[model samples]
Target: MQRFDGRVALVTAAAQGIGAAVARRIAAEGGSVIVTDLQEDKVAELAAELGDRALAVRVDVTSRADLDAAVAAGVERFGRLDLLVNNAGACVVTAMPEDTTAEEWHRQLDLTLVSAAQSIQAALPHLLKTRGNVVTISSVNGLAAFGNLEYSAAKAGQLAMTQNFAARFGSSGVRFNVVAPGTIRTPNWDNQPDALDRLAKLYPLGRVGEPEDIAAAVAFLGSDDAAWITGHTLPVEGGVLTGPSALDLTPKGPFRKEQ
Candidate 1:
């Protein structure tokens, strides 16, 4: 739609998956994008593919210095920043509460929650200058208990962080929001057999999501179309949260079977 013509966006973890999709979408819409990831080669390849519309930077999102450098490089290249997509995150560990160690929990929070906050901190000055907005990649895990305790908690915290920032920065014309995705076919599930098929049963849409699904929603929120939208968590989960209940659909209808 060329909604982003002449704008510049910085997207974290842009080497692949949803992050890469976001970078492609933004660039396709005529935005100059700064794509950051720890995988230098892949990030560079993406930037190359995007041609002059993109710049690649290797960044460890947990490191404040790295984030500052990436932001500086983006501003230096683009002249100003119009959007920040905090897509760098991981579900480092997945275990039952009792099986999850304190260290693992901290690691998850550090990767998913703390790093997003830090990225916002690094980009706030530029955002304030341009009256830009932030669109963070959260998950359906955050809104409901879908297992992965640590990841869920961290994702939930991202939503809260976005809301708080939106409230505080609205006066400055800076907006913050989140896109909570359901089971998307990403590299993380490459090891699993038929994972997308199995996950699709839980969603009313009869299929799991693609990276482009989430990217489309992020594009909408990041565009001028969403100028009046902020502090909202948009669920791009293939109707997972609103799907019919299995128990209710059962022959017994939420009751025990005949003994």
Candidate 2:
């Protein structure tokens, strides 16, 4: 039998990029998938392409109503919910910590942190009913500080939430875990030359990661193979976090310490 033959999955941000890849993979493994995004048209198109195995729903993850509705639609269509992938997120390229505007900060947090919270909250009942699992798409920035303050802060919040939720639901047979992807190549990478190069060099593998790479990790975590895993933050970073240090990349010098 296929690995996910009778499962139902709901993936956010499924119109494109990593979320889309994950949705496709789950469906390919025989799961019924609800592919949701704020971009209704693109999601609808992707859902259509996936045929009877997929359903498309328009959802703004930040909105509780939208998230609840999406979950309801999933249950109504698929008859049960077995997995929820909270993959919708956003980032802000700010000049400095102080320069980060309130609006930008809120937007980053709302999209990256609160959005996942809302989705998980809305899906909890159904997840509990099915003893389902949650696979959240966090970032390496959550574990270590990246220069993008807002993005890092929000992702950190997401990681914390993942752990807390896992602890809360673990006894009930619900599993929660995070897959933190480093420097993945997606449609969002266009026009960021400096970032792209820096990220590539940071990884021990010496190249940026691909969306499918992250998707594969998420798929594994959502499947029965990872049944014993929960509340863990797995880094799918191509050794970026474990690679050579900043000092190694710089010229050797007896650097002076500030008094």
Q: Which stretches in model 2 have alpha-carbon errors above 4 Å? A: 193-198, 245-259
Residue range 1-259, candidate 2, lDDT tens digits: 7778999999999989899999988988899999999999999999998999899999988899999999999899989999999999988676689888899899999999999999999999999999999999999989887778899999999889999999998999999999999888888878775787786866778788888998889889999999999999999998878854354577576887689
Task: Show pairs that collide, candidate 1.
Answer: none
Candidate lDDT (C-alpha), each: 0.93, 0.90
Q: Write the per-residue lDDT of candidate 1 for residues 1-259, one digit (tens) a residue.
A: 4999999999999999999999999989989999999999999999999999899999999999999999999999889999999998888766778898888988898889999999999999999999999999999999998988889999999999999999999999999999999999989899997877777888877788999999999999999999999999999987879864363365754766687
Against the true structure, candidate 1 has what lDDT? 0.93
Which TM-score value belongs to model 2? 0.91
Clashes of 2: 0
